[model samples]
Target: MQWKQNLNHWLHHLPENDPLKIELENYQSDDKLMEDCFYKELEFGTGGMRGIMGPGTNRINLYTVRKAAYGLSQYIKDQGQEAMARGVAISYDTRHLSKEFALEVAKTVGAEGIQVYVFDKYRPTPLLSFAVRHLNTYAGVMITASHNPPEYNGLKMYGEDGAQLPPDAADVIIDYMNEVKTELLIEVAEVKQLEKDRLLTYIGKNEDIAYIHSLDSIKLNDSANNKDLSIVFTALHGTATETVQEAFLAFGFTKVKYVYEQCGPDPNFTTVKSPNPEEADAFTLAIQYGKGNNADIILATDPDADRLGVAVKDEKGEYVLLTGNQIGSIIIHYLLEQKLEAGTLPKNGVVMKTIVTTELARAITGTYGLETMDTLTGFKFIAEKIQEFEQTQDHTFLFGFEESYGFLIDGFVRDKDAVQAAVFIAEAAAYYKAQGKSLFDVLNDLFEEFGYYIEETHSITLEGKDGAEQIERIMESFWSNPPLHIGGIQVVEIEDYMTSIATELPSGMKSPIDLPKANVLKYKLEDDSWICIRPSGTEPKIKFYFGVKGKTAEIARNKLRKLKKLLLQGVHV
Candidate 1:
């Protein structure tokens, strides 16, 4: 009944001839669909608002975009005239309505007397982060869903540092968003008027040139011969085309080939079932191209170009897709080794990763005498650490990555950067090829040196209000019961991040976890394997992460399968 009231309010406030009004009218007869869209306002999570594109309070549409932009405008204005003068930089992806939503944000913020800088075309999410810092803007916004389905689109806000807004800043914006009583009543200025008033500016070629030039700093072996290393790159119908092309050229990667079918912008992602490079299927075209050309390595970036996936040839001459963990470990080893050889390795170097990522990174960093620290699940938290290192000077930030295909090699861009990763992955490939080895060989060697580390992620999707309730119930169930053994391995430690406490099993000794509180649980077994369960922050899914180590790949895979089966058997929708 309350959903009906909310639906009626939208129908009344929206213009009779508006497209959303007609769409809402058509869906009103479907009770289930209507309730799901009108039951509540779409939440502005720590990363920002994301949802399906539709006509309800819970969907992403013009009015909701206006509401979010207005909230950001109010927050900027509260920071004083200087903040408003600094303005916000905005960019979008290849998704449908992405550019339109970006313009809507510009107009809404401009209406509040705030300046705005918008890209002339859709660009990578990291470039938007670079623009915020490059232009000294007060904030930034990226219109993208990252690697979500075609039906999904969302907006992610960035702080001045170009990282996703931290929790405290996000909370302020969420409070401002809640203060708005009527989304439909939010006013937006005309793009023409904003341009005439000089409140809006379009950024393109110059900014891109600056971004590409910055890649020079991340290149560890520019002098290494790259012509012999052939690479296949696929942008997956996203935004990495121009940047990746220029970057490879700048780095002397002359033998690179592009998967033209998936290079340009396609809102539907017609070339692949999904645009996510993390999925093996997304590399379908790249693999064909790789085999035909006998390429040394293949790389793919998601729609927003913030994450990368790599594939390399194994000793058997078969192409093997490397997991995010493996790619990160190889990069870490190459970076430290090259730096040490050149006598440029910093004494206080540090590598940052998420708690859910593989521990092999720690093993690698430890050997180099570099510190390895764990953050929560988001790259934003790692970005926050980068900012802290700048102020403290106690540690020199070297690299940061998460298990979900995201990586950041340099702090110039506060978010994960596939363009940077692409350059480095290729350089590493070339560097290894000179020694008569493949990227796959390098990964195996690292495993041989640091034990076999395997990681897997499983997700369960549940939609609508009922689905939300079910997720909460599942989290509560795990919190209350605290399993004693998983896969028959004795649990040695139980960490409840939600409670910010870690209890040593059997001993019952408790210690505080000096990290931000989140709804996550981690179980450490006596055998050095670990499992983490947490609700997805950006999607309608709950994810389970499992990691294990062994002397060989076969043993590690078997242990991982057992861990997944036994723990997942206990979780229910």
Candidate 2:
């Protein structure tokens, strides 16, 4: 393969004292490892770039990071002097090399005569979003892999609006990244020089204080005493422990307990196989603490604290982990009900969710007479809608969520916030507790009122360059050979997002989809169940999302399992 040639070239040219050189020497005997490391450059997408940490063009290292930073700097320069002066707000989570990468981006920007504001140390991803708006920076960058494994790390760039870079802006950065031949040869400003020139600033506590105060606005029951609620929270060995604890206490939640074992900044994530809350095992320790302390709820955030996972006591006192959809459903009901009663619900109020999220959100928000809008599957689209609301004044963005546990309760923080969700959900539990109802009970009540709606996501992981190609073929297969039926249900309608059209099966009727075009295909069944297929934007997986509403939970589970099995047939990615 040409990858060997690339490896030999790097080995010959890379400096002897370079840190990545040692990593190359260790793997020199392994051709497969060398191919994977040197085959191709990591592409920065709408969510920015992420990869395994090592030496090579394919890996996330100082050289590749420098290239990304150089592109970002040039992009800022292209935006004009005002944008360069406004600068970029930078932050990192507790992942390894997070601090170094944050500084790397900072120095690159500063070297180009652009200002840079960075956190003193590790902070959650949401705080970075808040900082971008708080500091009035031209853009923002966060160093994290979110919930990826310990060996992986990433860089996510955000625009001035505090959302992930939209398509138009991201294209500009990619264009600049393409022109750089040698990523490691980039220049960076010295830390001392930047500081002396006032081009680099350290953002410490004051911005955090502003964020904490904003969380106060999310409390539905501001006057409701939180004494009755007990919370067990774990940061999963990443960021969010201190900020969450402080915010909880400040909001009058005094009985909060922490899972001490998982609180430290251990980059290996020794406690769990994967530190992702979407998996049941992530909440193992937190649930144990919840049971021991008789806590009302258990909360777990990913490495960056943008995504939240929840576990609540069921009727039999079993700690049942709630899906992202379920938690979002509960939060929506609680927040909107309070806002409605207080006569605070805006006349033009709206709730937003990704197209892949459960329609249960639609039912709940519709009951409140709030308009519901669907964006392509990302929190950035929701944030875009929030920004649009501010300019047009046509609709007030009341709430936004994705089925992946990313939620933005208000526009105060433009990105998904687990710190905000943690405290707010605790308050929600307290509100329900005052009525002698558990969150599970509230969920059951919603099911009874709106029928039992169950949503499940099935993902097929494919890795490296070949896997990316296979994922594309799988998407192409779904597009060309559309299924007639799934799990005994007829495909009544198909929405091909890539084509931006909805087609009715029998009548052959068609209508345009208004949202941004994406590589997603959704089929609505005759029985009201639905299935969506899309390649995950952040990870190397083809995700199939299923949602079914049945008269009973058992029926929904059976239907979901059957459909998942059918979809898995002949698909090996």
Top lDDT model: 1
Name the top TM-score candidate: 1
lDDT on C-alpha atoms for all candidate structures: 0.93, 0.90
Candidate 2 is scored at a TM of 0.98
Worst 10 residues of 1 by lDDT: 219-228
Instruction: Quantify how close model 1 is to the true structure by its C-alpha RMSD in Å.
Output: 0.8
Model 1 per-residue lDDT tens digits across residues 1-573: 888999999999899999999998987789999999999999898878899999989999989988898889998999999999999999999999999999999999999999999999999999999999999999999999999999889999999999999999888888898999989998899999999999999999999999999999988886457888899999999999999999999899999899989999999999888898889999999999999999999999999999999998888888888899999999999999999999999999999999999999999999988889999999999999999999999999999999998998999999999999999989988988999888888888898999999999999998889988989999999988989987678999999999999999889999999999999999999999999999899888898999999999999999999999999888887
Collision pairs in model 1: none
Itemize residue pairs with steric clashes in candidate 2: none
* Candidate 1 structure, TM-score to reference: 0.99
